[model samples]
Target: MDFRKLLLVDDEEGVRRFLGLSLMDLGYEVKTASNGREALAVFEEFQPNIVFTDIKMPVMDGIELLRIIKEKSPDTEVVMITGHGDLDLAIESLKFDASDFITKPINNDVLEVSLERARERFTMKCALREHTENLERLVEEKTSRIVELERQNAACQVVNGLSSALESASREVETGSGLFNELPCLVSIHNRYLEIVAHNTLFEERLGNHVGDNSFDIYSDRTSPGNACPVQRTFQTGKGQRSRETFLGKDGEEIPVTVYTAPIPNKDGEIELVLDISVDMSEVTRLKDELFATRYKYQRLFDEAPCYITVQDADLAIVEANRLFKRDFGEVEGHFCFEAYKHRSEPCEGCLVDKTLLDGEARQRETVVTTLSGERKHMLVQSAPLHDASGRVIQAMELSTDITEIRRLQDHLTSLGIMLGSMSHGVKGMLTSLDGGIYRLESGLKKGDAERVDAATKTLKAMIGRVKKMVLDILYYAKSRELETEAVDAAAFLRETAAVGAAKAASAGVEFVEDVPEGLGEIKADTAALSAALVNFLENGVDACEGRGADGGGRLSLSARREGDNLVVTIADNGMGMDRETREKIFTLFFSSKGKRGTGIGLFISNQTIEQHGGAIAVDSAPHKGTTFTITLPRGPAR
Candidate 1:
């Protein structure tokens, strides 16, 4: 039914002619050759869709012809014709891409069925090839469309970027123009040729027709050009200029003008324009005249002021000094007050200047200074930072009052109060140790055993040691004993203290770590006093850890290092820390966290000793997190 031509190959002429006639009757154009060689020549000339040949021939065989036909036209189908004795040979030809085989005397029904099958196969192959070509064309079109879309997207992005840039530039120009119009002073802009290009409302109202012309022609009617016009000077030098002048307004009244002119640069870093601003100075001039008439009164009050006053910039450079400041601390100009009077290159350890600037408020601090003349002065210094209109700190004013004699009297009174408050606790601790020793001795005498007596003797010695330490703390607080200062190794002292507390920490199920750097150089101080202060801090850490371990275990850390010229000792514990109010009051006398177990004099005594050494103690703590007490002691003795 396909009307497709077929190739029937065999050596028999009779079979070929019959098949060719049969295909022609079936409405297919047909051709035939007797042997395989003739069939190949006829096949090429006819370009038939099917071929019929004999199995055995003179020059070429059916199998050889089958191979050649397929090589030339793969779409053509081959049907081999064979005799009864050559059936095996025809069957073997199927291996050569043969379509089908027939017997010697071909059955007309079977032969026609084979031809129809070959035509159906050829029709399917042509349909598949056409489908493949269509798919290839579709793929090419889709790929081209994707490339075009990508190119368009890139072009749109460039346009969008340019649009955003133009919008931003327009906004900036509008903001700058608005600010120039709203300013209270007279403002004008001039191009490189010295022609006025823009004038604000205030400038036009005051000067009338005089503006928009050269500044020299407008202001030089009564005075020389250089003396009257500051804008001309700024244009000539390409630098900023400021001066004062008297100008007659439109109402025929004279007004003082303080003019300031500056150059505006172009893209090439060259001054291509100038901006001039003029401020009316009538009120300022009137105030100055009034102050000039009362100068004597101000001079008298300045010299008789009680407090020393000095003006300094943010860098602490002195700009002005009052009479009292010069008289008391020597003339201090072009030098910082601390370096001039205290003779130090840097500020004191706990500087108040930083605090004032950070909080933007007045700060007060009390410090001691040993002047160049060997005079020790204690002063209460109060300073306030001065801010510009933009809220930027530019300068500071400092006032210092001599408080040496006053602080001495206050310290004497404070010492008396501390002694009275601590007397009961101090006396009780000593008596308790003394009583324990007496009781142990009495018990040993009654037992009458040599071993018991020896053990009791050691107990008595330990009790006596406790009593001696309490007496020393009391005497030190009262300043009743002279300090025995010496150079002591800080690292060695820290190791010894950690060893004593490590056992206690282990008993409480807490880990204790000692991180002391070895070979830390010695610091000049009273060895016994320094050791006592460090031990007190360690004891507090141990107590805090024990309290925290009442519920679960925590950690205790003791570390020491020589940081620059100071020796730093830190004791930290993971325990219930104090609140802000409690931390602030910890150094005060009679303040205790351990109600009955603590005498409250440990930290108080430590605070007094640290201050006497010209050192500092600070505590950083947070509730439920922990507390760390850092003690910093100077490497040298106090002045």
Candidate 2:
């Protein structure tokens, strides 16, 4: 139970404190003091519900303390403590409005009864205070609503009778009389007969008076043909309306203005007059034109920017794309940014655009893109956040710089470096052969030995042919290429490839030959590409055969035949074959096994050409067991 508080006071500590325990037992929070002066100080700070003070205490007796407390807080009930048989003091305390008398041989029963009475009164006082505050808050809310209603009604009254000054002297609005003259606006009022009864001084100064003329005739005569007169329409609809109108002023100048009309009702709640207010809108119209000019200026800049710019919404959908972005990405609006720019079914992993929106921070990433029309581009993408008023990201702006050509040039340079590394030894060996041939030819010319001269010439011719093939391979890898195909006899094609490989194989003392079936059918192929691809395979086989030791006895051969719907060509070499690692990476571009004698891109480019002809190539090789490369091509239309 929550307790009410009690204060006990007497000259002797024994009686006052002894009374405190009794009051506490009766469920009162008790504070005890030795005298009335001490009791008054405790009461001021504690604000106990009941104070019991003795009339004969030494400092400022009970009667005077009771008077002071009742004056300061009339609700705090004070009780007097009297000695046994001290009837007169108790009766005197009652005059000061003391709550109840307690005899100080301090009876516990009397204290309990007195304290309970004070608690009842305190609880009632608290309830009344809360009720009063609630009532005041409700009154304030109602007053605010009523004030807003009155303000709206006052505006309606002023707008309905704005130009009543010339109607009837008694019909003029009292409050708006001074406002009407001070405001700079066009104002007119017409009676139910549709005849103009009044006009503002400003209106009269600019458009002339129309005191007895009809409203429709006043505007219709000056109106640009088809537009309805705003004032006449108000009478027809019996409701207010607004429209833009241009008038021929008294000065003979066209003045553009926006007209507002309101219906005025009399005591019978029927339409009585139509009030027209027109405001000159020439300045607003000029500002709107300027705004459009500014937007047009920036729009031109955005469209013609050198870099690609795209505006994306919160969902990462491309909402707007500038001219450059549209030109490169091909009409990306209404598509998700990743789908439009990256051609991805889902968003790109670790997409910086998504990160920028989530954190409201700008981000940048470099990416490779294949466009809608199959052009590949490399872009440096920069995404920045566009935020709303509360600092939440609403959209993201991406600016992409095209680095496609630059990236292509870099790839070309890298391929060139790998090419130089792969073929340096081959070129060096060929140069040595050319130097020896020239030395032998010069020696033969001095000694008159035609046999030595002719042999040197053959060696030089063979080295030149091999070096020229390497140069062609380099040229093919350097550019974007297309195939030139023609119908050719399969046997004739195999014979050509063998003739080219025979010279290189002879230099290494290996047997190089082709086994094409006599009745092989004609096939459609890019002859140059097909020959180049077949030469690469034959050269690799010869090179593998030469890698064997002098006593190992090497052989390289090519065999071709038709198998079902495919042309199967197999090149085999009985020499040093490849291990598992080399076989796996044999066709990988820039991967070489011949130290400095192999151009790693030769096999790679060959595989690409064969695949373009709707073909596939497979390699079977094992260490010291020799290697076989099989090429399969469909005997169908070219890719």
Candidate 3:
């Protein structure tokens, strides 16, 4: 691989030289800039693959430097160094897709880790860009040839047939990019038995075209598709379906997509093949919202919805107001939700709608509303999060049902739906993993290949064992299954956990470590539940490590020891750690930092399971700093 072309931007000469040398020590070809203005000048000539800049600088600040560099060379990874007080500004830099950031007075380890992550991002960006360029060129060449052939034949049908033949040939050029793969969406075709038949560019790059992986598993977010996956729903119902869904991308980021699936039925009206299509709606959502705001401004029920309905964004800027909302609250469009509804210049205290935006979940509360007629009415309000195609909450729809007339009222109740969603994500992964092994085993069996079958068998056994454990845990929690607490050796337990996670880490090019003193004393614990809890922690850490960056081997470790009468276990990783906001709700149901990649159940389940064992989970983390999760369990046996 070519050396990473790096650029350093800082007003202070010592700061630039110091950081520049540090990168050079890591085998990078470094370039230095005195300020953002100089950095831009060097950038045009040096074309740096990665950049490190101080947030504060002369002529141009790091944020401006980031904006310019991205506007021009978006593929270049930029890392910012900011002070503690500039934390919020640094976060805003990330919105511009900054690779990573570090605090001022940076620790060498943290800086190195940040650079390593930037390296990984740079690699992926280059690969995707190259793949796209190659595809475009190939399409052009083939298209020109087809045009030449069409000119030689004046027959329209012949030209059309030849043109289509070119497309078919183009589709067969490679598994990653198809003739139509350049289209603004992920497209694929699958056969019966859930096997992927073919796929396009974005599909292959984002989600590998692993030939035999089950479609249900590949497309589903959680253990089960749960009616959210268009492909699964279509296959089951033998009908076309369109909806929104989230898929995990390369590096484990969540990709929100709008999906459409249709079945290609045989002559007897029997489905033999299915077509899957998904589009990234980030660039299109604003247009969609605009269209909805105009076209549906007077939607049929807007004048008739029994409740007050309001649509607003994060700033509480009212996007649209229903007829009832208008009459009761006065023409509120183009005004703040709070100003219109509560007559307050600032947002209402404990704003439930605002909370929905923060975590991308629904919120409900009973509030008293005053009408223009000077009457107070009791209303049960529900604010549902409206997410963009990328799964980030962008807006919310508030619906308030009037309950003033009712003499008796029931308490609002919410189910643990997030738990079920997360379980489905886990199940989805296990299904595909086991399917891959099964495919290899079956293929080997047909060819009378013992070695292949033997290897596949091992894989199948391990994956199936994991699935069985998860199933048992769910069943036990449901009812009737016996729970047995036993004396488990600390070293052996941690070693096994490390072993379970090693393969995953290796696959992602991450380093997995286990450190537990031999003969570290046994602890009384519910073997299954505790094991499941710890494994969840391990898996999450592994995932975060991968997302942070596999460059320089993303590090994850498991360590355990006995603390007096308490057994303490720690799972730590130098991965994309959480911000304070993210950390606060990680234990909440459906709270996922991984976007669509997380079902938000792992930490929640881990917390619940640990608490059940008379234990507590503590966390130490910051964005890009890494996270350490410590689990403290009582040493005594069952009561």
Give the best candidate by lDDT: 2
Error of 1 at 243 (Å): 60
What shift in Å separates residue 371 of candidate 3 from its native position after superposition? 38
- Better by TM-score, candidate 2 or 1: 2
Estimate TM-scores for all models: 0.33, 0.55, 0.30
Across residues 231-298, which tens digit of lDDT does each residue of candidate 3 receive?
Answer: 66677898888887777676677777888876766544566667777787655887888888877666
The residue-by-residue lDDT of candidate 2 on 1-639, one tens digit each, is 233777777788778567767667666788887776787788889987778788887768889889999998877778787887778988988898887887767656676776777667667776788889999999999999999999988866765564343234314422235455455677777777777777777777777766787675455244332344776677779788998887657676667888888877664446687777788777788999999998999899889999899989877899999998898788899999989888788988998878898998998989888766788778889999998899889999999988988887888798788677667877898889989989998998889999999988988887787688678877888774887778788888878878887876877788876788876787789888888888888888877887675545888888999988788999999878999999999888878788645667789899889998989998999887788989988775367
The stretch of ten residues in a row with the least summed lDDT in candidate 2 is: 166-175
Give Cα distance to truth, residue 309, candidate 2, Å. 7.7
Candidate 3 residue spans exceeding 4 A from truth: 1-483, 548-552, 595-597, 637-639
**What do the candidate models score in CA lDDT, each in turn?**
0.73, 0.79, 0.78
What is candidate 1's lDDT per residue for 1-639, written digit by digit as tens? 244555555555566677668767778766666678877877877787777666777789888988998889887888777777987788788888878887767787987888877778778877888889999999999999999999878756654554354333323323346665577777776666666666667666876655456665434243445454666677778788988776666676776878788766554446666677778687778888878767867766656778777777766778877787777667788898668756789876665665666677889988776654677889898988879999987777788888988998898788668655666665576577567767767777887766767766776675565556555665666664445787778787678778877766775677888999988888788777767777777777777776665447678888888789988888898878889998998887667787634556678888877877778999999887888999898887683
- Arranged by TM-score with the best first, the candidates are 2, 1, 3
Candidate 3 weakest lDDT stretch, 10 residues: 407-416
Model 1 accuracy (lDDT, Cα): 0.73
Model 1: lowest-lDDT 10 consecutive positions: 166-175
Choose the strongest candidate by TM-score: 2
